[model samples]
Target: MKKVNQFASSKHILALAAIAAGIALPPQAVMASQITHVVQQAGAVKGTVVDSKGEPIIGATIKVKGDAKNGTITDLDGNFTLNVKPGTEIEISYIGYKNQVVKAGSSPIKVMMQDDSQSLNEVVVVGFGTQKKVNLTGSVGLATSKDIESRPVGSAVQALQGVVPGLNIDTGNYGGDLNASKSISIRGTGTLDSNQSKGDPLILIDGMEGDLNAINPQDIESISVLKDAAASSIYGSRAPFGVILVTTKSGKAGRVQVNYNTNLRWNTPLNMPDMMNSHQYATFFDQAEFNGSGNHLYGDEERKKIWDYMTGASDVFVEEGSGGKWNYDHTYANIDWLNQYFKHNSFSQEHNASISGGSDKVTFYASGNYLSQGGFLRYGTDNSERFNFTGKINAKLSKYVTVGYNARWTRKNYSRPTTVTGDNFYSHVLRRARPVRAMYDPNGYLMSDINYIDAL
Candidate 1:
């Protein structure tokens, strides 16, 4: 036992003698032997670093802090196996990719990275956030209001036609439906029924939910189409069809100035329908006779009287004594049924005025518009009337507070028409009738229900 104690004492003496001689150990050794210490921690989560194409970049240089033990290159396939404590910061860089710095999250990470080429050019809007467009891996379409300003459409939504590659605007039946546009689909027909499947894209007006038609073409700024799932996932199920982001004009940082604009427009039909001939009408009438769904029927003499009355050929047949042809007159000849519904000329007048100014604390713009239109169709039916007003205000109350206000009102009306000829009412003063139609007695009343057509 005494010998063992003497050996331990000799080793302690040797260690002390060596330390006193200024013999220094490695870094870790330098700190513990009555020395101060410096250490670095890893902030990165393992396997989170990925390439711009979303593929792992093997052998990529990865380092966090000055700790050599915490720094290493990625493995083959761009995959990295790393271990970092929470709050650690890791910077990953590759030969062809941009350097990425990421802090360790509570759980594992799945980082979607971009290459140097795209990292600098691409961008993505994640959550309520936005990144470079070149950085995104999903599909999307974007355009400016100028791209569609040249076309004449009732609603602003229709302006998107052809701007986005995936969208389709179908034939519209609601003639001059100025308040709304034709149907639009971004992801193709979603269901078996093409008519029903072409749902509208979720439209956002200046960050708010609303119809696109409410804004005038002059007020639009930009439009972005979220066509892919990832590009629209942030909106959830509300975006099953797709999403349309619309940005409106806002006040800019400049001296206050008032602006004025005026517009005058004239419209003419691009196509005209074929006219009906008296001989054909006389023949086809008997062949394709509506047979009048009603019990009323007019005989040839009555038809002749009515036709004469319509043409003003025979001192005008009176309803009482006129056993005349109801629609045989040449007046039907001059009446182009197709063109009858529309006007020979339409006039549209528009005017707008606004003032905007702002500074470091606040900026705002206000504008008003007036529009008048005279329709082509007859009044009390198939007519048009509209008057609208809108106001908006935006202000920054303080360093941390902001507010905005908006209001709009519109008064509108449409006329209706009644016709026994059904669609023929659109343009024609004539209707095809069965030979039996002439049998109906006068008084514009049907002798048999067979000659009248149901109202569409």
Candidate 2:
């Protein structure tokens, strides 16, 4: 019995030993298998990033699929090496180029990214946010600063003429007055109310109500015209005619830059009226007087007096019965009232300067402009001067928050003849001055008694 019992005990001990060995070997073997599996799944991916033209694209980003945190940039040779799992997908991207995806495998992967020119991906400014241009369904016209930079105009509104279809701009009174602005109408007249106070399109400059002429053309970055209701309805009652959105230039995060521009212009009248001279005037008056009165009013006496005055034969004399004994010698005078009062050509000049720069956290832009415009009038002081200044600063407070401030100041000065009323100096006062009247007496001093020509 003792022998049997000892055999049983030895068997039990052998079984226990076998079980222990199995447990110890399995843990080590399982660990080694897991390490081999991990090593086999991981591999080095080598590839080159090229453009559609097969040109190497340096600085292109390569990211493993489903692992945005793991990425590398292409080197100078457009080559990249990444440690990724086999059969994993990698995405490649670059600026102005389309994104591409390739599976990581044993073979060297070559990624070719094409240019993305589709408007669907292009971001455009909308009401309060940005949207893709392709997603827009309303009628919108965009004009960049480069589009109107070459135009030499005093007002920014003039630069928009003929730039966009369905937008009508009329500057019929341009140069007539200093503060005159171009009349803008989108898709024809919006209202039939004959009142001049209404029917003008709304102009918004950087989210504020402002005049289009108030902003300098040099400071304009972009102008978007919302022509349809779908695009303009955001402004509610203020946009019955249409909406003009003006965005000024902003400083970029880069090196500081200074820019200066000047424009010189000359203007000449397209047409001038032909007026009757002294002889023609005298003859017409004599005929009219004779027709009115049955007898010849001036007869030979008056006719001879007019001929002698024009031919420098005698000085004009008013008898004591008329007003007083006033002698006016206009013998050698054949003055052109129009030419004396109006200049043949007028001059205008505009100068602008700007300073812009920025860092990652803050940016600033400042600009100033001066414009001087001369009028067609020569006798009267007719001129205009304008000065404008603008400053803007933008700061990034956080990754998703930003703050900005913009301020603008404008001043305009206009001078015209004291006799001029409502821009009618030429049409009312100058044109009505009779040709027979003298601008100056024999002494060369201004003849204030010349009733018809005294305005000159």
Candidate 3:
């Protein structure tokens, strides 16, 4: 025992003297030092993300395993450089593609992303909530903002024309009017009572009742048309005809973005009547009257005067009037009232601006829109102006809970000449203004009243 203790003391003294002389450590210490050197191997790791077909995948996310904050996105060339430890695992992910985890190395890495079929499933908004399109049993039609954003239309209904089956939209009697009333019907008119149940479908914008025309087309994200009863069962009788669900755009967690868009358009009437001159009108009516009662409505002298005046043989401008109370020789005046009162094309313009951005905890979006639409009239006060503003904000309060607020305001102003009672502008213009009459007298005074369109 005394010899063993003396041997251990001599070995300890020898090891301390070797360390003080800068001798190499034992095998276990050398192994530990090698491990420490490997762990300190941290630097920028470069990688390229590509699809199965070898095409570079732009905007792919490259994140460190278990570290969401330490991530980077692929640039336009599908290349990314992230500062991470060598041999560490990184997660590569992108929408419509499967996720991949690969070990980082000193050498460049190339990740091949396969297609994720589950990510291709389409999601649609329903009466209750959102559901996958394949899982929905009821009939629903979808229209994304891409379907209507490029259309030069003033109303959302106009943009949606012919986009969805069974969705009928009619511009109700006042065709071509800038502020014409629209009659919307889902499927068809099931009930005969047009007064109470006009077969108008229920339109909801972001879960609230709203006019389809009031919402800006640029602000729409998607439009879901609930056609069948099963699809609209959640809304009860309010959706008896059907329902239109409009989802608006929301902000995402990213850098702040501002967008502005504007468009100028001209609207031309397609269907205008071709009327006969005074000579043709007088001849046809005179012949009809003579054939009916064996007597002529216009004498031979009047007929000759109409024929001469309409043929440009007579240029004598003869008219008597003060203000719009003029009486001119109808048989001697051959005028085109429709062409004189209506313009060739009406001018319209729309402007939209929006700003959206947020952090992961809170997101916000706001937009404003303005539209100025001119009428078809040439001289009268006829035009329309519209304004729309929308704002939305959402905050994540907990892991599984989120709170949101949304507000929208819309205003429309229309101006036009008032017609007589029970008479609309179109019908009144067509009935009162004749091709055989004059819109102005020899004294340059108007030849029609304010209620009539001939005054224009």
Candidate 4:
């Protein structure tokens, strides 16, 4: 009886052990089966995306929260079907629209997205970093490409004229001078210490010190003027006056795009002094000479000769000597030097071409510009030609790593009459050139000695 009882006990212990092992083994299999069943039972969530106006937003993206691999794009009808677990949150997003999150349920989802105006407000670049426009506490002026794109100007600084308050841009003598560049000052003068050289506003082009004229207007993306201490202090001593930050255009991720722009301009002098004609000028000179030297000082013959010459009555001049000698002839005499010195109209041209393209990992932008400007001077050579090239590239080396490269080259050729000194053609030549003397003698040779117009 004891042996039988011990056998029964041993059998019971073995059964219990087997039962425990079976329970443990089946749990994993059961859990896996349940997961598979849940996956198989995933519901199809159908939804349509539209804008605030209720217009369909095609190509909108529908994605599962935190799951990049599981996403679908809406079709032409703005309808999307995504298979997701019940009660899963799906995100709907479209460019220029606010994102929407909705739960997957029995009912079909309709998402109406509002326009995202936050992007329009934009974040402004500061000396230290970037800040939202609303959060900026300093005095800042902003100008985008749209403000300057329509005007055909050679220098980027010219586009900013009259656009910003308290910012004085002086483009001295823009009419006929192709080499003219703008001088900028913020809030009048920053310092009165003449010994320390008056401070000029600091200009930065794409974070590099560069001439504003060298930058092509078409290549500009935006410009920010940092005024006052709070806006510019981060740059230390360099910001004592003010700061002008220029941002250049970068490539966008999309299909390749090509752009060509050309502009032709004609310039005319607006303020030319009306000078006396040759006859009137000769009379004035004769009167002046009479006033300076007493009329009685010269002999009657000499006085008659001078009057005849000034009156343009006789072409021949005879001087008394051992042998009778004749000097100059001015028969067909009257000449308008002003008409010959200045051009009625001057023409200039500009051509620009750009190509931009990008992929998910790489982007590139390249542009070239040619500009030809004609000066108003009619005599000799006066013109300028400029060539510019800019290239930019960006690469996403890794998830958190990005590299960028930019290069720009510019060549400018300016030509003017060698007789003119230091761009003083108008001030020295035109203003002083007199109309009494003829540019050429009767024989068509250039006259070397003429009292009124000898400088030419």
Per-candidate local distance difference test:
0.56, 0.75, 0.79, 0.73
Superposed by TM-score, candidate 1 places the C-alpha of residue 157 at a distance from the truth, in angstroms, of 1.8
Specify the highest-lDDT model's number: 3
Provide the lDDT at 443 for model 2: 54
Ten-residue segment with the worst summed lDDT in candidate 2?
28-37
At residue 373, give the lDDT of candidate 1: 56
TM-score of 2: 0.66
Candidate 4 wrongly placed segments (more than 4 Å): 1-120, 172-176, 191-196, 286-334, 423-432, 450-456
Q: Compose the digit string of candidate 3's lDDT tens values, residues 290-364.
A: 999999887987777667777778764343455654445442677787777778899999999999999999999
Q: Enumerate residue pairs that collide in model 3.
A: none
Which pairs clash in the backbone of model 4? none
In candidate 1, stretches whose alpha carbon ends up further than 4 angstroms from where it belongs are 1-132, 148-152, 177-181, 194-198, 286-335, 378-388, 397-401, 408-456
Q: For residue 68, give model 1's deviation from the true position in Å.
A: 58
Number of the candidate with higher lDDT, 1 or 3: 3
Better of 1 and 3 by TM-score: 3
Report backbone clashes per prediction: 64, 0, 0, 0
User: If both were scored by TM-score, which would come out higher, candidate 3 or candidate 4?
Assistant: 3
Task: Tell how far residue 278 is off in model 3, in angstroms.
Answer: 1.2
Question: How displaced is residue 370 in candidate 2, in Å?
Answer: 0.8
